[model samples]
Target: MVNPYGPDTRGTFSFGIRLGLLFEVQAACLSAICVVGLLVYLGWTAIRTRRQRGKHALPSHLHVLFVSLLFSDLLHSIGSILNIPWIRDSGVLEGPLCTAQGIFRQMGDTGVALEILAIAVFTWGVIVRGWSSPSLKTTFVIVGLIWIFVILITLVSYGVHKAAGQVYYGNTRYWCWIRSPYSLPDGIALQYGWFWLTAAINLVLYISVAVTLLKSKRRCRNAQMPEGQRSLQKIAFQMTWYPIIYLITITPMSITRLWIFTNPEHPPPFAATALAAVLLTLSGVFNAVLFSITRPTLIPQKGHDHDPTVGGLRSIYTLEFCQRPDEDQRSSKIPPSPETPCHGEGTSKGGGTDETYV
Candidate 1:
């Protein structure tokens, strides 16, 4: 009798053998649980928001990018969760199901990376560059472009591989993906490159935003920074954690994949591969937890939307730092009123006015 699975045990099938398969199974199961919890939370929130329709309308315009990110995470988690079936069977092989997993994995990963990048860029523009929130048409256009790009790349790769009589997606030791032989081109082009790109851009944008806020704070320090400025600064710092968490979740798996790519002759240790799978699968959970931490108030209180402290992450979208230099002189002439509390009031000691971003 033959082992049937490849001898890549050391040089192949790192997780293919029964001894190491448990790790992948466990990782997928864990991801499923978290994904379900996230779904429940979203559903519950939707129900509550609907019930309070008169008091609170869904801030779909504000959270367009956010909702897209959550959808991507869902697809990615489902791809990982697919591994549960393989685990129960004790083996994986190339087939339609395998192909489906690979496609979902690639699409979801690419979508998530792109969505994160979009959010980071949008946030920086609004907060640091002083740009207004994007119009709904522009938002949908951007989101559509991202999905189109992801689909085109994945399908193109699949077509090319199929036409060449190759497996576009085949079994790795643990899960199905671009397969070992084509991992270099397909992996980098379809999946990992997006992750790396998002990581780099997000790190830079959030850092720049944080630094800008800090500088603004220092300028207002003597005058005593207004609560609005202070809140902006705090949120800026908190936003940095988004990229950090993203990096942490993807790093272990990235390292393993790169290691395998460069040194095909020497497969990583079983423990390394297993650990990487576990970490990578938990990305959805990591993202969910990070969002919860960064954006605590998903639904604003009935009448507290204007309250910066209670606004949560929504404040970043709705609050402006200081008025633009052009608006300052004119805005100051108008007296503050109930409808515009932060308009002309909240002046700093330096004769500059601090207004909540309207």
Candidate 2:
């Protein structure tokens, strides 16, 4: 029996279907493992950080970014996991499942964009201020504002299309995503506008982060302490990977989109689409792994020299800074403790001696 919705053997669609299925299966397996690992790592770190909250200064901003990245990657992985079975059976974009898949895909897409933006901002903050980056209040406010803005833009674009009696429906697909073959001017404009907006934002943030890291490294080179050089080097390496991965994942899509726009008569090379999907999928996994490896603090393990005690102490001051004036005053009202000598310091009784402040 002939399959109407199946891949066309004469064209690249057949090859694309095969390739996408292969990649999706591999991605699903890898992503499933990664998701489990991430969840375990996140749980372990959260518990450890919480226990040592008083003794160690936590990198709260970095933690926020880490959480966001994990969440986004998890969502992306979920989308892939769902799509893999569909693709394997050649049932993608069919029935109600297509709409469900589209919703998940959109969710993953938005999550990924927000994750990248959050990481960029977090990295930039670190490069600029190091230990004195913006307070949690400021970071939260900024993230909230960015999310709200993106949501508004998506709604407006969606509404405009629907109002024009251009509500797109598909026989091959169930989701209401912007239909492909965007030959119409309005369709092309919307598609390109989103593409460029995301890419531009990513480029600007990454460039800023790279520049800042470079400048910091140069400054550290002239400093007396060699430890500064090591710290700066680590940061430099981590910051560099982000832009590299971003370009690797997005460049193919950018080129393909441009080519299709310029040469409307020809369809985009199927290889490009396949490459883009694979690279983007891998990017999510890579980001999660890179962060965990680079920032050892994010992964809690025994025998690691990185102390959470100092991080906890730092968190206190940072938290204080983020609180309201009245709350700050209330916190400040706590009396300072008198100096005390340890039990083993002097006395045979093994008791400490307390001395009052002058």
Candidate 3:
């Protein structure tokens, strides 16, 4: 009589398997907890302040983007949390349930790409093209477009999964994403394929913003322009590090997975796979830190509708860095610091550095 759950554990050590599985579970669980807390707080604040902004108000930069991003993170973290039990126990989940998990995982992965791409595009618009704040309706429209994009792509993948059958979670990947996550008949076309394209678009936009900012900064210094009127690129740079950080953190997983795809005969070291799992799982945590979800809102009275009397700068190019003595009575956060390059950026998530790996 053959055992139905067939115990063919060749080339897989029991202790090593247990340890690796435990680590993956812990990373995903912990990351989920930390990131979800941030998401909750952000969502609550957005809801509470909705009416306070007055009617027909347009909030400062990318209000919809932050909220949409938190939703995606929530989906990501929750999917991981639910999968812990499934991954640890021996058995298959209900068909529709597994299908739901696959969709949620795709939502998070694809959703992130759209979010970062939106931010990068936003940065380019403000810096290069002199675009200003988008109205509330316009912002919601953008949010709708992103969500729709993710859903359509996810359905495409789900269609493929139903046709293929076996392997929904934890075949090649440790977490609860589509199995053989970065490979294919279907994986590349659905999952990992988006990785490189998103990364490339982000890099180009970041470079453009960085160069434009530096040039503007130097010109301001030479001409002795009023300090208050300098471009806010340095500070803006802080908020723009997400795409860069995302790329840096995901590179390890990408490289290792590619190697496995190319050299299937010789399995890569368990350690390599473990490192990748660790980084990928901690992604939401990094996003929370980068966005400063725990800190005070950077733009005050932001939720209230736009007041024409508000003296905020017209575009990022003309944004003021130094506060004038007259405006000191106001509750502005940006401070004066002429000598240091990246100084005055509060340790808030807006600082142009990433703590994701750390």
Candidate 4:
């Protein structure tokens, strides 16, 4: 007698089986918690920023990009939170449910890519131009263009296959994926194409932003900045660190995709999936952490000493002033020395001088 759910056919008892399973469960739980927290934080921040701006407006173009990123992340987190339990109970490599899971996963992937692109572009623009109010019209146009391009590409490739035949429903985990019936070459190509293209774009954007930030930091160090302005610069540098976190968490998954594309015959079973899940979970958690730390004013402060308006205004003024070479040069000029006080009865040349403030 043979059991239907036995290990022999199902490919259980594999390397790192127990550990992988435990990690997957833990990652799912952690991701869910992070998603909940992120949603609350972002929602509150958006509302607060809107109210402060009056007429429900974003504080700046960069702020708009940040909001878009948070919104996309929230969507991805929600999808993952739902999909994880279903994957656990039903198994990702089996049954009709896999198709649904694949679709959701693909959507989440798209959201992540869009968010990263937005962050990279926005940060680059801010660092390069010192834009205080990024044109909303321009931002919306860029977002529209990206969405349209992605949709067109997806439709032209995967849409045709799914429409022409029953490409989705199968034991295959290729629901949101494009695959061939007889040969694996086409499927492999499509998979690698998507992963590599996204990776290349992300690498370029992040590297550019990182380089610009380093240059900015160097320039700032050479210039004399006020305490408040220096604090703002530090916050901006800290924000730049999120891209490194993005690269670390997403690079492994990209490499795994490349491996699978090159050698599809013997794809690692639970290990690869579990690893990808862990990376994605970490990405979501880190993003939430970054948002919290970099934008503390977005959080509701009860009896807090920090004034969000003054801080924001000072940051804006500093950024604007720093952009002007003439202003910077003029600011560096030395002030006239204070006039010497006349000596009194007990005053000597060194000891009797009046205390003077610049």
Candidate 5:
């Protein structure tokens, strides 16, 4: 019997069904587990922070942005997890589930790309441009604007298609997304455009930040370099993984999608498609690993305020270099130790600051 959910001839639907059997379902399941693991890690960290409430201050602006990025990744992973249903059915069907999957995928993909770009920009601003960390209020406003844009585009594009009696979130390949005919501009403008743009911007911003940090590191080799300066350099070294992880996760699927767009007649190679799916789905896992690796002190313990340990989430989440508070005016809540004096009140000659707490 012929499958009603797909065309009788060769096309996206047929290939998608074949592809699902070969790979998509397994990748989707693995991705779902990874996303869940990341969520549990973050949740546990938050709980630990809460128990130690006053000891550790609330999360910083940069920390909030990172959480937002993870939230977006969660959305994307949910979308990928939806693939199980389609793969089990062995074909794509036009229905609410399909629409939901498509919506989640678009929103998640767009959200991740935008968030990555925002982080890159913020990091560049703080490190390369020597700008002060933004206020929590400002960070909320920025996040609000990004979500507004994400929701607005999603509504407008999908709504227009619905009104015109068109299938905007229908089968394009192994998933429900922009279908044929309108897939070019609609898909590109709504999602892929942001991905590619963010990738390019990430490359430039990260390269600049890396260069600035390298210069600071070289200067830090001098015996006269402040301990705080050395700390900042070490933190910067760990941060080098940010763009590296992003590029690895985003590039393969991006190329695959672009190829499908350009050469619609010839489907992407089976192995290539499978690889892209696996890599793309593993984004959350990669990010979670990076988070743990870079933010060693995500859940700081009490009494460690004076710990000589430098770098990690202390820089990403708590450091505030902008105000450069007067030494006398600094809060006495967290006393400074000779080994790890609160850098909140001073700046190094190389323009780095210890600002390790609001």
Candidate 6:
């Protein structure tokens, strides 16, 4: 293949650039929606919780999980703001500009993958051990560590490319990224070593979560736990959908990239690249809808919050705390119909939010 900035021998640039730009731009628009929507949601949550003044504290752990995701998604979306007009006019960017774009894109890509894996672990922790929400200090620590890791890994790619003395962030097909990542050491590390490994781990974690849920169900079979208190629907939805959607969206790009590596003699199809570009670019958007917008439906509303012992002692004495949610949910006292528990109820709290989580 000819260098994107070099001679135009392969005739690849003619069709590839325009097609890639078109799809990427569309994906950028969707990415914008994802970022804006998430920010609004986070802001609203913060203000609402503040007004409540500790009366209705939000779940810190869940907040950390989603906020970290938002940060990663924002990075992913930022890379979508390509200099289309500039690119069309100049036909090539300066080396530094190209390098920056490449780095930014990879940060977003790997960041999202890593964040998803984090979420899987979070779900498992809450389910298997009745883990509480993270403290404010812990939240910052986790987020900081994630960013630090991202920065270090991205720098590794940059260092490798610099050492090669080749044009770093050279134009690949239509866009800028680590060129020939499958072949180059730095590129391969970013793509194959980091990104793929995260996705693989996420798969394993989710599968483990599913199996654990089944075993838990068997253990609590005799208990009269409300279905909502079991949080089966919510857990099942995430455990099933999160990994599945991620795999589905990422497969096309993974396949196309690997194919190019294995079979360089034949060029990849334009249609395949277009599909991959759409999926890659809109990943943030899909995640916002799946992980953010639709997630609240699973949380039990304050008024609708079901008391695990609503039916009286007949059910309470026989109910297993193992099958019940957090301790606040197991409390025998009758809470006012409109009053939220001081402690947060987890997914197993009969749709109630974690009360002690505050």
Instruction: Give per-residue CA lDDT, model 6, range 281-343, as digits (tens).
Output: 777777777755334432436874333322211121111224334435556453322212122
Q: What TM value does model 4 have? A: 0.68
Off by over 4 Å in 1: 1-21, 43-47, 50-62, 224-232, 299-314, 317-358
> TM-score of each candidate?
0.77, 0.67, 0.71, 0.68, 0.79, 0.74
Candidate 2 per-residue lDDT over residues 1-358, each given as its tens digit? 2222332222223545666657855775585577568767767756665565434334455556556656656655665566554545544443344434444444555655665666665555554334454455666676667556545544565467558855332222311234443233533453444445656776776677666545544543433333322543454456557666766766775676567557645747666655665666675677767766655455445785354322321221121111122333334344322221111111112122311000
201 in model 4: Cα distance from truth in Å? Answer: 4.4
CA lDDT of 153 in candidate 6? 82
Which pairs clash inside model 2? 55-309, 56-308, 56-309, 56-310, 56-311, 56-312, 57-310, 57-311, 57-312, 58-311
**Global CA lDDT of candidate 2, please?**
0.49
lDDT of 1 by residue, 20-60 (tens): 55665566566666656765776676566556443433443
Model 3 spans with C-alpha error above 4 angstroms: 1-13, 47-53, 56-58, 90-100, 160-170, 173-182, 222-233, 293-358
Instruction: Give a tens-digit lDDT track for model 3, residues 1-358.
Output: 1212222222334456546656766776776776678667655655544555434233444555765776776676556555554445533344455556667767887777778778778767666554654444666888899898788877765666567854443333333345553344455665567777778888888888777666656644533333333434444656557776789766887787678667755657878877776776677778777766322253345553332222221233333333333444344455534432222222222322211100
Give each model's clash number.
Answer: 3, 10, 3, 0, 0, 10
User: Which pairs of residues have clashing backbones in candidate 4?
Assistant: none
lDDT of each: 0.66, 0.49, 0.57, 0.49, 0.66, 0.59
TM-score of 2: 0.67
User: What is candidate 4's local distance difference test score?
Assistant: 0.49
**RMSD in order of candidates:** 6.9, 11.3, 8.7, 11.9, 6.7, 7.4
**lDDT for 265 (candidate 2):** 57
Q: TM-score: which candidate is best?
A: 5
Judge candidate 1 at residue 322 and give its lDDT.
44
Global CA lDDT computed for model 1? 0.66
Candidate 4 stretches greater than 4 Å from native: 1-22, 48-53, 56-59, 74-96, 129-133, 144-159, 169-223, 300-358
